[model samples]
Target: MAHRPDTLEHAPLGRDSAYPEQYDAGLLYPIPRAANRAPLGIDDDKLPFVGEDEWHAFEVSWLNGRGKPIVAVARFRLPANSPNLIESKSWKLYLNSLNQTRFASREDVQRTLLRDLAAAAGGSVSVELLGVDDSELVPQRLPGECLDDLDIDVSDYTPSAAHLAVGEVIVEETLYSHLLKSNCPVTGQPDWGSVLIRYKGPKIDREGLLRYLIGYRQHQDFHEHCVEHIFTDLMQLAKPEELLVLARYVRRGGLDISPWRATPGLTPPSPLRLARQ
Candidate 1:
């Protein structure tokens, strides 16, 4: 299988008196399929949130009959208040199941996944599926640039410093990005990749900004929710004149998802190209 949970250790999540690794089998990443998972933030738990932007994905998968990788690009939109939004862990588990699936055609795979993911998320999710030979339809450019992993240090906030309530940026009018590196709050297994944030408002404190991002260094949350939480934090804290927060995470189990959000009037920056691509 492209994604093998048996070999990949994970953080556990469930009810157990002994407090075992919070690993959730469903939270497995690098799904055998061409997919990825992203959570907004762990702190956004206290707020009411919804999916607002369009999700564009470029996926490469292999067919059971051909044994060659087939490429697909999907665009899914979730309602702001869609109930039963598939939790990150569960979503990963679901994608991994596709490994053994052999669809008659790419359309069948697209239709099935769109229907199933939408149903699991409790809202209509749109998907644009494409074969490897068809590449013209996917998004061409992305926002921001590749990050240099600034050797961030989080010694002070290492052991549960504080739950994420909100973040403050010390830098003024700047563009910053950090590769996303987090773990399952349960198992402590690391989830990785990059994140980009750009805004036109007063620049936030860089140190504070790093601290905010670092806060999640040890904390665990889904990629989609993490980005969303960051969006909410900016709206609540700095309230920049114009703001855009986007993260392009590396693929796990062959899947990756990028989430974006902004104020009603402001438009999000285009997706960017990073080394991982």
Candidate 2:
């Protein structure tokens, strides 16, 4: 039953809107990250993890100098420590604005994206425009054992840190589940995704972990916030020496968002899409 921050009051989500006729940097909307983090007991100046939000835009199209249409995909990386998180609907609308705009070259489009996104994020944002045939666009499965087949009783659908527990056995492992689903805070639309956990510490109770993840079924939040919540919950319950929590969400409006949070010194996982993405 968490509510979106007051900063999102005027965001483009949940309301009807028309596509922009031309490029408009002003279309991008940003919500302060601290607003959501405050409730989680996370301080903006002392974040517990390091990571980024990987975003892919699959329906990008623009005009070349010759007035011919150019189609390509885009990848964006926004640092987790950024001051703000861009609103997804506004991001879609901002990208849609480029549909009829003309750019001299792909680099030109990328530069514009980088500048605008970085400004909105309040941090440096990585923007890459790739051809549709780029290999990075190929889908792959998430690493580790899938927890979807476990037969466990569950009734609650709200997230609770108490559902997470760990055993005495110490081990290093990776586990994942595709049943992670949460609703959008603004529009209440379902956001389906797969979540992966990697840690080196006491053996976590798989059933409890799965139940904890499933508890978000009726939760409301953004993909980045959800991953952070999972990460924080695990850290509090297991006290792992190392931990990483990642969520790869399905595409909505031609875009997919994957957010990962990890203890310092752990390398990030490959930014690859799952088959369902």
In order, candidate lDDTs are: 0.50, 0.91
Candidate 2 local distance difference test against the native: 0.91
lDDT of 2 by residue, 48-153 (tens): 9999999999989999988999999999999999998999998999999999999998999999999999988889999988889989888998888999999999
Off by over 4 Å in 1: 1-80, 88-104, 133-154, 158-174, 267-273
Clash counts for the predictions, in order: 56, 0
**How close is every model to the real structure, measured as TM-score?**
0.61, 0.97
Please give the lDDT score at residue 226 for candidate 1: 65
Worst 10 residues of 1 by lDDT: 31-40
